[model samples]
Structure formats: C-alpha cells, structure tokens
Target: MITLTDVHKAFGAKHVLQGVDLTIDKGTSMVIIGGSGTGKSVMLKSVLGLVTPDSGTITVDGNDVQRGDRDAFLARFGMLFQGGALFDSLPVWQNVSFRLLRGALKRPKEEAREIAIEKLRRVGLKPETADLFPSELSGGMQKRVGLARAIAAEPEIIFFDEPTTGLDPIMAGVINELIREIVTEMGATAMTITHDMSSVRAIADNIAMLHDGVIKWTGPVSKLDNSGDPYLDQFIHGRAEGPIEAVR
Candidate 1:
C-alpha cells in the first residue's frame, strides 16, 4: 500500500536516507529495525511527507505523497508516538477523540466521546478511565490511552514509533499484543520503527533492517534468522562485534 523508491534525504551536512527503498503491502504490519541515528525515523517521515526526500518518490496506494491535499492525506493516518504524547490538560476522552473533535473528521461532542470510550475499551482501558487526566494514569494506562487515540479515527494506516519505550517488559508485551490485534482487526497497514526484538516478533508480518540511511535487508519475518545479511544478523542478535560498529 505504501512504496518508497530510491529515496534520499539529507539535512545540511548530515546525509540521512541515502537511498531507502521499501514497500509495505496493504493490511500488513512492517517493522523497521535499526540502531540509533540510522535514519529509520527519517525514512518514515519521508513517507509521511513530514520530511521531503531530496530524490526519488513516495506513494501511498498509487498516489504521490508530495502532491496531495495535506490534510486529506494526513487524515488517513494514525500515529502512536513513542512518548504517549497525551495532552496533560485534556481529559482522557478528549485526548483520544482529539482528531474527531476537529477538522476533517469532526463529530458531535457526544458522538466523539462515545467513540473514544469504545476505542479505549479496545485498548483495554475502561470507560471510567475516560474522565481522568493523563497525569492521573499509570505508565501502562497512559500507553493504552495513546493506542486508543491512534485508532479513534479508524485510519487506513497506522504508524507506531517505539511503542514499547519506557514500559516494563510485561507491559511492553501487552502493548505489543494489543498493537498486533488492533492492526489485524482494523485491517490497517502498519509501519513501526522500534529496536525491541520482542515487539518486532509480536507485531511484524515482515521486517526491514535499515542502516546507514538505506534498507540493508527486507523480507518476511519467518526468514529473519536466516537472511544471511551481516547487518541484519548483528541487529537481531544484538551482537557486540560484527559488521556493525558498537560505539564504546
């Protein structure tokens, strides 16, 4: 459903996304794995049109990302940010329905609240949690809220940025399962960028390893262990010595 061909992006002296080429099939979950500063985020942002590539092209369902109505294009996507990113001032319901309460997807306040409650329930949050503030929730609950917000609009595409960050292992597992189930149920195309191997195994139908601003390997998850690509092997095994240099 999404495709990037020979994509390249650079910021001043920093050459990020030197030539990223990837394709995400419809209704499939794709996980991008890479170490810090390898431009995974840059590749994702290029697809989202948040970061323009210096060369090549990005298309979603055959339409060029750079030539669309920004709002309309963006409305088709949902994002679960790494930090949860909930507005501290808004109540839980408000935060979940923030998209529905304004702009292209606007709905009646009551209707939006109802939808928010349903989405919250899907993410394992109770309706009673709706009125509480972000500050009042535990870390796991806050993450659930973020997931609820991401699905509230029923977006065709979902992006997860380090979804398991800051959570305990158990909670991270829960989040991974929820993400997998929700994406499958909604039949949404998912693109997740995370270093967590557990999350990759739980959430990905396919995997892509990005390094040095390029896709070093891309294939089905079943073949991950045997890809024979040194870069991917180093990443998946967390090896200290390999083609990848571990900074001391």
Candidate 2:
C-alpha cells in the first residue's frame, strides 16, 4: 500500500537515509527494527510528510505522496507518535478526537466525542477515562489513549512509533496485542518502528532491519532468528560483541 524508492534525506552535515527502499503491502503489518539514530523515525516522517525527503519517491496506493495535495494525502493515514504527544490541557476525549474537532475533517463535538469513546474502548480503555486529562493517566493508559487517537478516524493506514516504549514488560505485551488486534480488525496497513524484539514478534507480519540508513534485511517475522545474516543475528541476539558497533 505504501512504497519508497531510492529515498534519500540529509541534514546539513549529517546524512541520514541513504538510498532507502521499502514496500508495505495492504492490510499487513510491517515492523522496522533498528538501533537509535539509524533514521528509522526519519523514514516514518518522510512518509508522513513531516520530513520531506531530498530525493526519490513515496507513494501510497499509487498516489505519489510528494506531489499529491497535502491534506488529502494525510487524511488517508493515522499515526501514533513515540511520546504519545497528547495535549496535557485537553481532556482524554478531546485529545483522542483532536483531528475530528478541527481542520477540514471537523465533525460536531458530540459526534466526535462518541467516536473517541468508542475508539478508546477498542483499545481497552473505559469510557470513564474520557473526561480525565492525559496528566491523570499512567504511561500505559497514555499509550492506549494514543492508540485510540490513531484509530479514531478509522484510517486506511496506521503508523506506530515505539508503541510499547516506557511500559513494563507485561504492559508492553498488552499494548502489542492490542495493536495486533486493532490492525487486523480494521484491515489497516501498518508500519511500526521499534527496537523491542518482543514487540516485533507480537505485532509484525514481516520485519525489516534498518542500518546505516538502508534496509539491511527484510523477511517474515518467523525467519528473524534463522536469517543467518551477521547483522540480523547481532540485532536479534542483542550481543554487544557482534557485527554491529555500539554507538560510543
């Protein structure tokens, strides 16, 4: 459903993505694994138009994202940022339905609140949480709110960035399962970036490893352990003494 070809992006003196190429099929979950600062987030931003690539093409369902009308293009997808990115001053329902309350996608307040509560329920949050502010919730609850917001519009595609970050292992597992269930039930194309192997196994139908701004390996989640590539082996096993160099 989404494709990137020969993509490149660079900051003044720091080259990030270098000739990156990837394709995500419709209704499937593709998870990207990489160490910190390897441009995984940058790649996601490129697709979202938050970071415009210096060169190459990004297309969604045959629409060239770089050339298409911005608002129209963005309406087709939803995103859950790594930090939850909620407005602390807003109530939970308002935060979850922010997209529907303003801009061209605006809906009536009551209608938007109902949809927000429904989405929150889908992510296993109770309707009672709706009136609370984000500051009143725990980290896990905040993540649920973020997930609810991402799917509130019932978008055709979803992007999850570090969905399980900051949660305890058990809570992370719960979030992972919730993500899998939501994507499958909505038949939404999903692209996630996470370094957590457990999250990758639970949420990915396919996995791609990014290194030095390029996809070093791509395959089914089941093949991750046996891929036999030194780089893949190093990442999966979390060995400090392997082909991958730890950033000093």
Each prediction's whole-model lDDT (CA): 0.94, 0.93
lDDT (Cα, tens digit) per residue for candidate 1, span 106-206: 99999999999999999988899999999999988998999999999999999999999889999999999999999999999999999999999999999
Pull out the clashing pairs in model 1.
none
Worst ten in a row by lDDT for model 1: 41-50
Model 2 residue pairs with clashes: none
Model 2: per-residue Cα lDDT at residue 161: 98
Worst ten in a row by lDDT for model 2: 239-248
Q: Taking the candidates one at a time, how many backbone clashes does each contain?
A: 0, 0
What TM-score, computed on C-alpha atoms, does each candidate reach? Answer: 0.97, 0.97
Give the runs in model 1 whose Cα sits over 4 Å from its true position.
Answer: none
